[model samples]
Target: MIHVLFVCTGNTCRSPMAAALFNHWAEVMGMSSRVRAGSAGMAALGGEAASEHAVKAMARRGINLAHHRARPVEEAIPKADLVLCMGHGQAQLLRERYPRFAERIHPLMPYAWGLRTDVEDPYGGDLETYEAVAEKLEETVQSVLQKLENSRET
Candidate 1:
């Protein structure tokens, strides 16, 4: 299986949501067995539940985040086939910290959607902020899964 890791500042908001969305979409696209997802935070304290707004936003899309916990990037990166970061700074930090895995690290927007912006963090924001981030993540993760499928085909 191909393991993809999504990274952000705190696993509570963006990364976990992205992983949940990716896993859901992958199963829907019949690629769940081949591609799996995980999430971590560059600065997480570990074991913290996802943000309240994040959980509600995910529930709106029929996805669950109540059981999600925050984890540090160090615990997830080594096993990932691809390390997609929510921001360019996070990607660069991982690349520098794990030079051997530098080639596997990239910003999600640029690599998946060909955009140059960071996936916004909605940590302390309202439900609308989390919803917007989820929408963007949904589109990007689907695009990334398609790219992964194409790469495997080739």
Candidate 2:
């Protein structure tokens, strides 16, 4: 199985959202048994649920993220085969702090085909911003799954 971990500043928002989307995609593609997905935070305020706006935004897409709690990076990194970060800064931070695993870390957008932009944080933003972030994340997740599928076929 391919273990993928998504990381962000706080696990409450972007990372959890990405993990959920990817997990949902994996199931839809009939690859759930081949892929494992999770999320973590670089500097997490643990145990907090996703932002209110984030929860509602995901709900619109039929994704329920209301119960996700923040987790620290150290909690998830060691076992992940691929560690995808939301932005360059998060990737850089991981590389600097854990150079041994740096090669396995990458920006989520780039890892997701066609997307080269960073996934912005929507910590305290309104529903509109959360929705935008969710849309971008869903696009990126599709691309990411494509890449994974391609690699598996090789």
Candidate 3:
């Protein structure tokens, strides 16, 4: 199975949402058994739950966030076959901090769809911001799924 790790500044928001959304998508596409997905933060404040706005925003898309807990990137990095960051800066930081795994790290947008835009952090922002971030994440996740499929076929 391919292990995919999604990361951000804090696991309380973007990364968790990315994990949940991708997991849900994987299940729907019947690819969950072939791929293992999770999320973590570069400097995680562990044990924190996802923000209320983030929960609600994902709920609107039928993705649950109840099982998420903030975790450190180190916890997931070593095991990941692919480490996807929400932004280029995060990818740079991961590569600089963990040079051994640099080749496995990538910005989620460009890695998935060749789009270089970062997924904006919505922490402490309004629900609208959270929704916008989720929408971008969903689009990127779809692209990621397609990429994974093509790779598997090869």
Q: Give the TM-score (vs. native) of candidate 1.
A: 0.98
lDDT (tens digit, per residue) of candidate 3 on 1-154: 9999999998998999988888989888889999868999998988889989889999999988976789999889999999999999999999999999999999998898788798899989999999999998988887898799888999
In candidate 1, how many Å is residue 101 off?
A: 0.8
Better of 1 and 3 by lDDT: 1
Q: Give the least accurate 10-residue stretch of model 3, judged by summed lDDT.
A: 138-147
lDDT (10s digit) by residue, model 2, range 26-144: 89988899997899999898787888887898899898998899989997899999999999888998999999999999999877764667899998888898889988888888788
TM-score, candidate 2, is: 0.95
Query: How do the candidates rank by TM-score, highest first?
Result: 1, 3, 2
Worst 10 residues of 2 by lDDT: 109-118
Q: Which residues of candidate 1, in runs, are more than 4 Å off?
A: none
Top candidate, metric TM-score: 1
Candidate 3, residue 32: how far the Cα is off, in Å: 0.7
Position 54, candidate 2: lDDT: 77
lDDT of each: 0.94, 0.89, 0.91
By lDDT, highest first, what's the ranking?
Answer: 1, 3, 2
